[model samples]
Target: MCEKCETGVEILTRNGEGRRNFLRGGAAVAAAPLAAAGFSGSRAAAQPSDALAQSEVQAWAARDTDGTFAPYTITRREARPKDVVIDIMYSSICHSDIHTYKGDWGMPNFPLVPGHEMVGRVVGVGSEVTKFREGDIAGVGTMVDSCGECVNCLADREQNCLNGTTFTYDSPDQVSGGVTYGGYSKRIVVTEDFVLRIPPGVDLAGFAPLLCAGITTFSPINHWDLKPGQRYGVIGMGGLGHLAVKLGAAKGAEVVVFTTSQDKLEDARSFGASEAYLWSDEEGLRSQMASFDLMLSTVPVAYPMQQFLNMLKLDKTLVNVGALFPVEGAHGMMMGFGRQSLAGSMTGGIAETQRVIDFAAHHGVAATYEMITPDQIGEACERVVNRQARYRYVIDMTAA
Candidate 1:
């Protein structure tokens, strides 16, 4: 049985022998679609009889702080009663992955497998799993698990769990007693609640980035309740910035792009910006001071925060989603003069993550990406750091 939670997310439930019976009956119903889709169960299935048994899967991992990836094998814990095992098809490289791999964020757990944005087909489910079935197109994002008893989790804010949330990779795993591995592998086993369903008729590869970049931008927009015809300013036209322009415009806001790259001005407009200007254009920037209803900065590097904050109208907000470092060059006067607010956001909670994915599908928004094989991850990381990638890079894990 299923019922809607306060966030309007359907919560699936079953108990005791009823759950086992449902799994036995649902297997055929699930397998029929997989067979029709040419899914061969030879390699994907993980129906281990013992709960303590583990499955060895092939993956690429960064052995050290150098961030170079090489072939490795990792073990996935057997499916628990509420688990779903996925055969990964594509995994997108997130900037956070690069940061973690390079130790830019801190000393990561060595031999880390860094990935979060992934889309795959369900291959197996635990005996009590009810929300997903074999062959469902599903995704896993930044988080895999959170302490469900926390007030934040109960409120559908698992990303902000007062108890530590288990990240997709390199976080202390509460369930397995080791660090969590991520989707840079051939397969992964995740709890059904953390797995997301991909909407039909969407580009699977293109949709992968929606798990991270899409939600990162949408959460802030959703939080601020950006209204139609409001002037929305986006800083930086990289991965997050490009998506912000697309999403902001889709929300009926008058989108504007403020980028450091002259080349991105036209590209920004193409992504749905009504106006595009170089951030270095002092006169051009000053002309629009206090004119924006909301502004979002997606630039990872430190820049003049006061400049972007100056663009907001009184009582308006400027949200930061990209920078992980200290924000400099802003003072109390910038905020006090207009009652303006500067805030930061991480990826959304599970329900909000699903909403963003569905929202993008309904509105035809997706990341523009370049495809590469797992072997190219090293080079791709370099490209990402150099800002050479057009927007995003998605790995074809099947090539491994």
Candidate 2:
């Protein structure tokens, strides 16, 4: 058995009865009618208290472009009728968090508490919330809310909502007025629809990266409809790249990895990749041209795109889940010859995020991560920026 599965077995042994009861309770609540739950379809009538009570909580924040984190305190709004209050246990550091803090993406709002991948236990639930209850294992990902009535949201693609999707942090907070504080803090209040239910027995720290790195890669795989025995390619072997390998292999694809680091080639193979190659392996890469049915690039920085696009089969696609910047070196001729396409994917929506979580649990796939205390967040972010993190860095919120 994999190490993740063995750890899960230990957790299950410890929490077996509680997990069963939690599952049963969740199902019963889901089946209950809105009327029985004291909820109504009207938005105005269902609104929570206008007073918006707030409480101060401890956290870490980046005060400037230096990206140095220091002790801070932020206020959290009390749970509304449709919200869930989670006491955060683990928060995973994502590369984007560093980008935002360092102003690489843009100048974020000052005093930014940067974290989106979080897993914790529910401590409070709004009166009308039916999806979760106190003591349930839950998670919050890259997004917190969206306009539910938009065309995209109606179709279950909340990430592309017509009005605008509210990100977990550094986005406008419709309720609290300034901005939404993220999971680097001790507690967070999120709407019930945005909260994800986590499988009971998995390692919470290992499972935290699934909120961002896992979903970012899985969304494209799902959209492309990757099938059994298909050739799959992943570029870069960082946090996102490794998860792509595990997820793709779990779906029965013959997964291959391409990376600049010689060390990660072997690591990729251990992560279920059928083959791994360095980008410098011109002969090996050229041999695989026009052979891949689908490819995903998880490199956060700019890299040559033409080589990967050339490897896609006719009518196939190379999806970019990272590199928010404009892609260069991808000429029209490279794509026109093969009738191939280049696409981009954001993080998954609510339902899709939940699906990835459940899928990871069932497949025994978990991130290889190093644990750190909240005080070490700055050093951890530095390591991530320097490409030193082996896979992921997860914050142990309970530690000093």
Candidate 3:
């Protein structure tokens, strides 16, 4: 019998209309009334909301391989209350991870583990967790913790919590009493608030980067709710830009891709872009000026924005998605003639994050990812920062 809210299903003691509630009280209670009778646990999902944690596990960690990455083994902590322990099936390598791991963003913690786009199942859940249970599929993204009582948290904008939001890795973990590690490992333990519930039927492997790459692109588009027939330009076609392309198209808007690479024109169109605007082409440049409702620049290098600002019409915005040097345009008034604005955004609140996931699942929008093993982490990171990778790279932890 399936319980209300699809909480779980119980094995019936009989068949068809003859069937009454069979195995009671748990999601994993197994077998048809005509056959065997025993609990099969659950599909690494569908676990009852009140099951115990499993024991023993494995993982791949960051190790030095001649200034590159090599494999090292690691352990997972047991689950506790409000905790959802995920056995990582896949993880994605992000540009931020590459920057932080190489110490290019500053002197990073040595052997600083990297990976926030993680997908897996709940091998365990803390005693008080009602949101998830053993075997339920789950994910953790760029953020992990926040001050629950802050204005942002109370308002469902935990990404901008009054206190600095705690990153999944490289940030403090109050429960662990130490710096947090990331999804590159075999398992991850996160609070119920930070963990995401995935819609069923998608491939779990390719879904990892959707946690970060998908959301990073997803947040800004959703925040504005730019409408149908509205013009939106996605500036770049790398990991993040590519996602923006699909998301913008799903919004029922005309999505234009702005790229320095002419070779990506076909790719841009293939990835849901209605049009491709080459930055160097005078015609494209002229058409972009004062034309778009929103322009999201995902290029990693600093670019002169005077031209970009000229492209926004009245009440329009040119938002920065990529964190490049020079920070913001030096001349704010340059954006004012058309009443245009310049802004920047990070990921999003847990509520917004959930909404994006649901939206993607509904629209069948997914990130394009090249899957690799842990040994490929270094090369993947290098390519990401060097702007060599076409879109995104997801680590297949199962292969590791």
lDDT of 2 at 96: 91
In the range 290-382, model 2's lDDT, one tens digit per residue, is: 999999999998877998999999999999998999997898986899898999998987777776887798889999999999999999989
- What is the C-alpha local distance difference test score of each model? 0.81, 0.82, 0.70
Predict model 2's lDDT versus the native: 0.82
Query: For candidate 3, what is the TM-score?
Result: 0.83
Per-residue lDDT of candidate 1, residues 273-343 (tens digit): 99999877889999889999889989877776987898899999999899888988877976899898999
TM-score of 1: 0.89
Model 1 lDDT-worst window of ten? 1-10
The superposed Cα distance between candidate 1 and the true structure at residue 21, in angstroms, equals 20
Give the range where candidate 3 is weakest over 10 consecutive residues by summed lDDT.
Answer: 30-39
What TM-score, over all chains together, does every model reach? 0.89, 0.88, 0.83
Cα error, candidate 3, residue 396 (Å): 0.6
lDDT for position 264 in model 3? 87
Rank all candidate structures by their lDDT, best first, as comma-separated numbers: 2, 1, 3
The number of the candidate with the highest TM-score is 1
lDDT per residue for candidate 3 within 1-400, as digits (tens), equals 2231111121112242111111121322221111111213223432434323433345444544223676554444556677777767778877777667655666665566777888776766777766665655677888988887877766666778788788887777676566777888777778776887776666565567778777777777766657767899898888889888888887777898988887889989998888997888888788767889888888876777778878888888878878645664536676656788778887776665665666677678887878888877777777876677877788877665
* Better candidate by lDDT, 1 or 3: 1
Candidates 1 and 3, the one with greater TM-score: 1
